[model samples]
Target chain A: MIRIEDVSLRHGQTQILHDIWLTIPKGGITALVGPNGAGKSSLLSLIARLQPLQAGRISVDSFPVDTTPSRDLARILAILRQDSIVTSRLRVRELVGFGRFPHGRGRLTPDDYAIIDQSLQQFDLTDLSDRFIETLSGGQRQRALVAMAFAQGTDYLLLDEPLNNLDMFFARELMRSLRRIADENGKTIVIVLHDINQASAHADRIVAMKSGRIVADGTPSDLLTPKTLQAVFGFQMRVETFDDMPVVLHFR
Target chain B: MSIAATKQASKTGWVAGLTLAVLFVFSLCVGVDDMPIIRLFSDGRALELLLVSRLPRTLAAILTGAGLAIAGLIMQTLARNRYVEPSTAGTAQSAELGILLVTLLLPSASLLFKSLAASAAALLGTSLFLMTAHRLPPTQPFLVPLFGLVYGGVIGAAVTFVAWQADLLQYLSVWTNGDFSGVLRGRYELLWLGALMVVVAWMVADRLTIMALGRDASIGLGLDHARMLQLGLIIVSVISALSVVVVGMIPFVGLVVPNIVSRLMGDNMRGTLPTVAVSGAILVLGCDILGRLIRYPYEIPVGTVMGCVGGLIFLWLLFRRPSHV
Candidate 1:
């Protein structure tokens, strides 16, 4: 379990997240949904220790996040942010090979290569493994990045809006892939998602936030109601159930 | 591709290694004094100059070239942009300023003292660059290097002004030339420290690589982003500052060698550092040899030859539409 207690953050004088408390249970897909400036990314950063904590405690699997050795932390958790820009011309396989860095320290043994190859196949990037990352399109590049994270072999995977800039088909495919990884591999996945329906369809649990505070947290079926949507997004939306999942119609 | 083609592609390093070795031997032979090859070892004065002076200078050039190239690779990786290097990004100028200040203040300061001052100054400049980067809105990351160039140019102009007024322009020119002539046995020992830094850099290469991805990603992976970056900057400053101290400012050696090596051998630091070292050695040695050949007895400085040739090569590398991905 990932537990956050009284986490507060201030950028200069402006408060970003205030006295936030959250708990993400193990072995499932949890989607964090919020509007812009809602501190979803900030909270993720704090949990992952990407940014230093100003005033809170975070623990991953009972170990305090702040005190754990980075290599130890890397073993348990892997994070993929929205923007991963690598300027060097690295082939897709080489990029995925970096997933083994925390474990092998850049000298990959046979086991590391096996894990890398498996990750490439899992992400359906086996065909493009030899291609350079710069040559790949947006969706392909995102897959390559996801493949790398998967290759990390961490139990807890944190993705900050992994679907940004992906087209409709690729977005659904990626969501499906994440769902499979979480279900089949039994990995605990925490993803920040913009599309409410994607969260509703794929997420086992949905945590809604606004103004840096978690207003609601429950199963997607329980949390994706029109009332909660109105409260969280400040918008009136119609909701319908398809395949036993709540789909919010906010487009019109 | 055919079997021969595949084998050829895989042997890029070997080809580069052979070329560098050949060039090194040629560089050893070519110099201001055209003593016969057999007499080089027998003649006492010639032997002393060649073995002690020329040999050290050549080794200094090789080490400086390697250190600078790796430093550039680190900086470019950290910044996540091409077209950025320590010299172009102002780190070298800041180091030079530090050296100039210490020299002016304490004329009797040892070379080590000057190097420390230069390292400190380079560190300060790099910190300023990073802090300033945080406040600005996101755009092309290349803006960092552009700003660095402008910043470096301002400091470089100031250095020139100071040198002119102090009637130390000749002294300043010597530092700017990237020459290997003055490097002797005792004076050039400082370069061994840079080789140690390269080793340290390799040990921390994993951390540096992750940090290069993005601040958030590195943090998510639980790496101390700030400390890693600070460490990288420290490495870069020490290498650039010491390179300047040893053989003036040999401009594009840093930019050209790493880019070439990264393109050829993958970007992994473990795989590429050796190639970068060899390629840097070859480039500098070739330039040094060319400098000797062009002017003969006059002995043009290695810096001028490198700048002229390296500038043209850099332009070609930048504009050649980049064949390799």
Candidate 2:
């Protein structure tokens, strides 16, 4: 379980996240959907300890984020931050292998390599494993990044916009991959997503945010109505059912 | 991407090691008052010269080369910029400034004192550059190195002005021009300290490689990013300062060698560090030999030759496709 209590973030003079309290239980996919500047990424970063918490308490399992040793916390929690750019000339397998660092400290055992290869296979990246990351297309690189985070072997994963740069086919494939991992491995996944329909389809729970505050939080059927969507996004959009799922017609 | 390529990279590594060995032997051979290969067994005076001058000079060249190349690799990781090395980023100039100021204050200070002063100033300068370089728009990556060039130029000009006011121009020239002709048995042992920094770097090679992934990624990977950064700063500053103190300022060995090796062997420092070290040693040794042969009787400074050779390679690095971004 990941717990966040009374979390607030301020950047310069602006309040980015205001008294945000969220508790995510172990297993399942929780999608944080919001408009721009809604503090989804900021909240995720604070929980992941990517940035120092200003006024909050966050813990993964029983370990306090503020006081926990990074290595210890990393063995349990992995994060894929938005805007993560790797400029190094690294092959895909080697890059994914970096995820095992906290465990092996760069001296990877055969077991660690198996985990890396498994991650590559999970993301359908086994063939592209030896390709340089720079040579991969943007979508392929995004999948590689996601694969690396998965290779960390952490129970709880915090991904900020992992679907960015991915085309429709890969994006849906990635969401399905997340769903498979969440179901089979019982991994606790918290994802920040932009496309509402994607969240409505794959997310077990959707937490909608607006103006640095959570406006609505519940299952997609209850929380993703047009009224809540308008309140969260400041615009009206029709939410209809397709194949027993809420397919949000957000387009004009 | 194939087993063949991996085999080929190792092949290249072996070939580079061989080339470096050949260059090391050739460097020992090309000095003035040449001792033939048989002279060591035949003549005692020639043997004494080899131990006192040739051996020390060659070792210092190799050590300084390896040290600065590793330093450059670390700096690039820490700064997250490929183009900034010690000489281009005001580190070497800051060391020169610190030495100049210390000399003006106390003309009779010990060599240790001078080196400490140089390292301190170098640390400050490098940290300042790394801090500011990130603030510039990273979209145009050339801007960081360009700012670094100007920053190094400003520090260098300040050093020159101070030296001129005190009429220490000759002293300045001796310290600024990198030449190993003055190296003797006990004189150049400070580079061994720089070599120790390399060993420490190799010990923490994985952490340094993680740093290339940037701060957030490094922290996410469970590295103590701030501590690793401090270690990297100390390593670069100490190596740059030691080289400046011992051999004046050898330009481009740091910048040129690391990039070439990275292009060939990727960024895993643990896998590529030895290659980077050997490649750097070979470049410097080869340049020193070229400086010897380019003018037979009178020797050209190694720094001057490197400025030409490294500058051309640097231009090629600048204008190349940049390895597909």
Candidate 3:
């Protein structure tokens, strides 16, 4: 379970998050959806301990984020931010192998190799394992990065816009993979998504944020109505049922 | 994508092997006298010169190259940018200025004092850069180097102004050119400290690699981000300053060598490190040999040759598609 308590973030009189309190459960997918300037990324960063917390406390699986050792936190939670760019000349296998760094350091034991290969296969990147990351297409590269995050073997995965740069096919495939991981492995996945329909389809719970506070949080069916969507996105959204799931038609 | 090409390519290993062999042979053969390479071991004075002078100079070049490359690798990793290196931080120039100031202040200062002063100055310059630019985005890697270049130029101009006033420009110019000709048993011993740094860097390779992912990534992975960055920066500054002290500023030995090696060997800090060290040694030694061959009796300084070569290569690199990025 991830718990955030009275978290208030301010950067020199500009408050980014205000008294934000949220409790994210241990399993299944939780999509953090919000409009622009909603502080979704900042809140996620604080949860991942990417930035120091200014005026609140957060804990992951009973370990306090501020006091926990970095290695310990890394083993517990893995985060893939949208703007993470590595300019080093690295092969896909090597980048994925870095996911296992906290466990084996640099020496890849047989077990580490197994995990790396599993991650590569899971992301459908086994063929491109030896290829340099720079040579891969954007969709392929995004998959590789997601695969690396998976290879970290953490129980909780905090992904900030993991679907960026992915094509429709790849996006659905990625969401499916996350769903399978969540269901089969019982891993806790928290993803920040821009596309409301994608979140509605895959997310077990949808949390909507506006003006640095979560305005709504409930099951996808309960919280994804046009009324809530209107409040969250500032526009009316058409909702329909498809195969017993909510399909939001917000394009118009 | 190019693993097949990498497997088929013998260029890297071949270059390393050929350069090492050529440097060894030339260092043994070429000197002040007309003593043939075959007769050196038998002749007493020739043997003395070979063991006492040429061998140490060769080792110093190799060690300095290795040290500088390691320093560059650390800096690039810490900054999370391919273009960053120790020399880009005005470290080498600061080190030179520190030595010059120490010499002027105390004419009878010990070699240790001069080196320590240079190292402290380099550390100070690096800290100043960090303090100023720490808040800026790391994507603009060139800003630090540009700042460093301007800082170095200012120091250089200041040194020149002082030297001109004191009428010691000739002495200063000689030191600045960075010739390894004076390296011998006692004089070159200080460089072994840089070799020690190479070992230390290798030991911390995993931590450095984690640190390369950025402060947040490293912290998320349960490492002390600030302390790790501090440790890496310290290693970078110390090695760079020490290398400058051992052999004057060998331009681009840090930037070009590590970059080339990383492309061939991939960015795993462990694999790329040894290659960078060897490649740096080969490059410096090869350039030094070229210097020896061109002016046989009157040696052109190694720094001048390196500067000319590095300038051309840097221009070429700019035009070419960056392999690292």
Ranking of all predicted structures according to TM-score, beginning with the best and ending with the worst: 2, 3, 1
Of the true contacts between chains A and B, what fraction does model 1 have?
Answer: 0.57
Candidate 1 pairs with clashing backbones: A50-B219, B177-B303
How would you encode candidate 2's per-residue C-alpha lDDT over A1-252 as one tens digit per residue? 888899999989999989988888999999999999999998888888889999979988978999999999889999999898989988999899999999988898989989998999999999999888988999999999999999999999999999999999999999999999999999999999999888989999999988899999999999989998988988889888988898888898
**What is the per-residue lDDT of model 2 for residues B1-325, given as tens digits with 9 covering 90 to 100?**
3486578678878988999888888877887787887869789888988889888989998998899898888888887888889988999999999999999999899888999999999999999998899799868787888999999999999999999999999999877878888889999998999999999999999899889998888889899999999999999999999999989988898898889888888887877888898888888888888898998967998889999999999889877855443
> Can you give the lDDT of residue B241 in candidate 1?
86
Ranking by DockQ: 2, 3, 1
All DockQ scores:
0.50, 0.73, 0.55
Error of 2 at B184 (Å): 1.2
Clashes of each: 2, 0, 7
Q: Report the Cα lDDT for residue A46, model 3.
A: 91
* Model 2 chain B worst lDDT run, 10 consecutive residues: B316-325
User: lDDT (CA) for every model shown?
Assistant: 0.81, 0.90, 0.81
Query: Tens digit of lDDT per residue, candidate 3, span A1-252?
Result: 999999999888788999998999899999999898899999999988888889989999999988887778889999988887766667898888888877866678889888999999999999998887888998898898888889999999999898999999999999999999999999999999998889989999999999989999999999889999999989987999888788899888
